[model samples]
Target chain A: MTTETHLVVAVLTVVAVAVIVRMVRRGVLKAKYTVLWLTVGLVLAVAASVPTLLDTVADRLGIWYQPTLFLMLAIGFLLLVAMHFSYELSRLEKRVRALAEELALLRGPVPDDTADGGATGDGSG
Target chain B: MRTAVIIPAFDEADALPAVLAELAAHVPDHEVVVVDDGSTDGTHRVAAAAGATCLRLPFNLGIGGALRLGFRYAATQGFDRAYQFDADGQHDASQIPALLAGLDDADMVVGSRFSDDRGYRVGRSRGLAMALLRLLVRRVTGRRFTDTSSGFRAFRRPVLEFFATEYPMEYMESVEALVLAVRSGFTVREVPVVMHDRAAGTASNRNLRLAYHFVRLLIVLLAGGRATGHTPQVAR
Candidate 1:
């Protein structure tokens, strides 16, 4: 990582952290999501500040290309996050569907009294 | 026994009037409960005008979701039995007695179109899909169901109560609900019944979406096991 690029990454991560903190104070983001984004920001800041950190880790993994490790990690993280999002979306949809059903049932009326006479006779009619 | 006809209508104002009229004529004693699934067309108004109980949803939930709502209402209203009647004029009101009579021996009765030559003709591809679904349903439930996708069905009180909450809220839910009822130790039987194509209002045709839902149903049947366990009364 070049020093200039590292400086940019670090600055951007700091700005992101500041924004996240502000959102937290304003209660804009849910705690779970705020924690998720803050953890991501923290990891990016650490990686930017320590240029050799990634390289050392890459060497231990026996990868000739150090950036490959970073790319792999980023891709894996993103895939997992995307899967989590889909799971959350499915759950939310199910809840909304249940709520819709409940609403309809609440508004649903009692069947008319015409069945009163029929209940007495054989339903063959 | 109080029998409720649960009609799940979605923008079927054009078709519902005739269907409800036929129902009232054939089974005057059976009260009808129509669940309007967020229709832009005043489906709710037609249902209410029919002198039937109507429940209007705030937004569109698919057929399965709408049916679940209808079942929930029927069960809560102390209905002893309930049968699903199509709002699109596809189900035969004259067949209601036959369909409901099956309930005497079984907890759930499916009005099968293919059991007799009476199953209205479908395109070749749809026929093939129907066959595959029947095979899979047979495998899943270890019981052969000639018409796995038939929406015309009747359920005894226990089945209605069970389905009030646990009914599958997805496309091809009829098959899932069939397997669910069987797995829950409820007796399910199929009766030969004639069905007609929609007399009015067009089917919301989407080949691609139907294909996707078919694949999803396959995966759920194979992996999730339509039984999803005997957990009682949990709405999904």
Candidate 2:
């Protein structure tokens, strides 16, 4: 059972667009990443709707296997996204560490985790 | 000169009481600041009862983080100098004056155990690693150091204030801090000092973690990290 490349990619584009829209509407994805996935969706939409677009581009690039071009581009894009995520994660970790140190400095030698501070407060009402 | 002893303790309650007592007996004029590294034990109470100003961290941020807080506290309180002493009683309080005496000539004094025949022994691989680290330190800072990881060290007000915010937060931070200070153009010296075996509690040395941190430190040393600490903010 052989499936045509256009049909497969078309189905994938529909599913990807639906999932991306749902995720964005549900507020699960941040605006920055939402823009990223939306751009990915738009590229997929262009490739699927204009069935000859990938073939035309791949042909111009002299790639005999059109799907190879798609796969290569996808892999490259994913690698860049992964690298960006790693950079962001390192930055966030540093900020969080700084916050932890700041919190410790502000809390002083005493810990307000216990109910003692609240209990001693004027709860006369 | 106003001096502070920065003791970073994590579950060393058994040994800390004696350590604090010795510090009090030996260096009465020096203020002691104990950083309780989120110990589940009553380490804060031990430090407080011993008349040491204890800063209890919300959670364990490792030894580097604890010392940073202690340094920050000491600097903000206007202490002219500070020395780090082990909470396990491995560090002798009598030698504190000798450590501080080094401040007369250098901005930072590292109490190196290998400077003389102090008989401090480690495993063969660990010794190799330390030797490699010593080489790396010498290469990066353009200076020689016999011990790169000795916790027994002292710093003047300028260096203490500098480390208040810029101390490395990594596991093996002493070496990194050493490199940072030297790279930032501060004078550093290593002096021979005698340290004892822990009177209580096990040393926190895991080969796996140590090896991992060793590789990370190799990268840090070779990679030319944030070495721009030569700001004019710190007064001479």
Candidate 3:
């Protein structure tokens, strides 16, 4: 119930809400990415409210202080961004290939009158 | 034959009314569809007032994306031919007849400024750049085009379908369409035509930026393939 603890809780609450809103807007919040961001946001919010949990994790990971915990958070955000970019790149390649196939068909040929007649059973072939 | 001219406009409200007027005067029978490529300016209103069917994109999709939408409309709406005309008044709409005339023999008839020994208004450096592009395109596709970069061209039904599917979003390297058509055994004829300087905005790709594009396009074409022979066309 200290003044600094109250400020940390307010800031983390605001960040968790902002990240949730962004995820919702991008439509990635519905699936695995959403769950991951939500978990991180929730954990950070709880750690702000109860600072002892931070010291317990720090002790378990053999970290001397909470600054090392901050580094883990930064790495998690970078991993998420990299994963999103790769997904977008794969989607673009599939789109390009589909387009190329359409072009191949349209530019194929005008069916010949002879083939049309033969296929229709006129038997000129 | 019913034809629709799709003029893709991007912040060219100043020059569009004049171009629409010229199109109406020379080719009154053809319908004009102007796709405003997400212009912040009042391009849609101006185009509609000037008597063109206006389709506004939600955002700027560049020239190729706009043209693909236009072509799809032309195909589904039952237009016999679809022609792409620029909004800056650089292309001469009077040459519409020649493009239509060559349509029977070719799937697409491109307006080439260098076709019949015609001169260019572009400077010496730009002129040389175009010459090198023609040579590079020739080497890659085994075909030479006078104005590989000209936006003034007409497409028959099949070419219309071809572009709707796989149109390049970038500007530099769309000659893939022409190369793909030839590979699929479609005939592409280059017709001689005059291109005027922009009446209102500047060229989309100008000067050093333009030169860089040709070099980049050349690399793509060379890397794709140089093995060229006749792709036999099925007789219709």
iRMS values for every prediction: 8.9, 7.4, 16.9
lDDT for position B235 in model 3: 27
- Estimate, for each residue in B1-236, the C-alpha lDDT of model 1 and write its tens digit: 89999998888888888989999899999988888888877676667767888888889888888888888788888999999998888889999999999999999999998897874888788899999999888887899999998999999999988887788877778878988888899999999998887533266557888899889888887875662222233443
Error of 1 at A73 (Å): 1.9
Once superposed on the true structure, which residue ranges of model 2 sit more than 4 Å away at CA? A1-4, A111-125, B198-201, B227-236
Q: What tens-digit string does per-residue lDDT give for candidate 3 at B1-236?
A: 88989888998889898999999999999999887776877776677667688766656766766777677767867788888898988888888888778898888888887788655477678678778777877876788787777778888987787666545655653575566666667788888987786533276646577767666667667787522211122221
Alpha-carbon RMSD, candidate 2: 4.8
Choose 1 or 2, whichever is better by TM-score. Answer: 1
Poorest stretch of ten by lDDT in candidate 1 chain B: B227-236
Q: DockQ (C-alpha) of model 3?
A: 0.03
lDDT of 3 by residue, A83-119 (tens): 9879877666445533433342343322333333333
Sort by DockQ, best first: 1, 2, 3
Instruction: List DockQ for all candidates.
Output: 0.29, 0.27, 0.03
State in Å the error of residue B196, model 1. 0.9
Clashing pairs in 3: none
Task: For model 2 chain B, give the 10-residue run with minimal summed lDDT.
Answer: B227-236
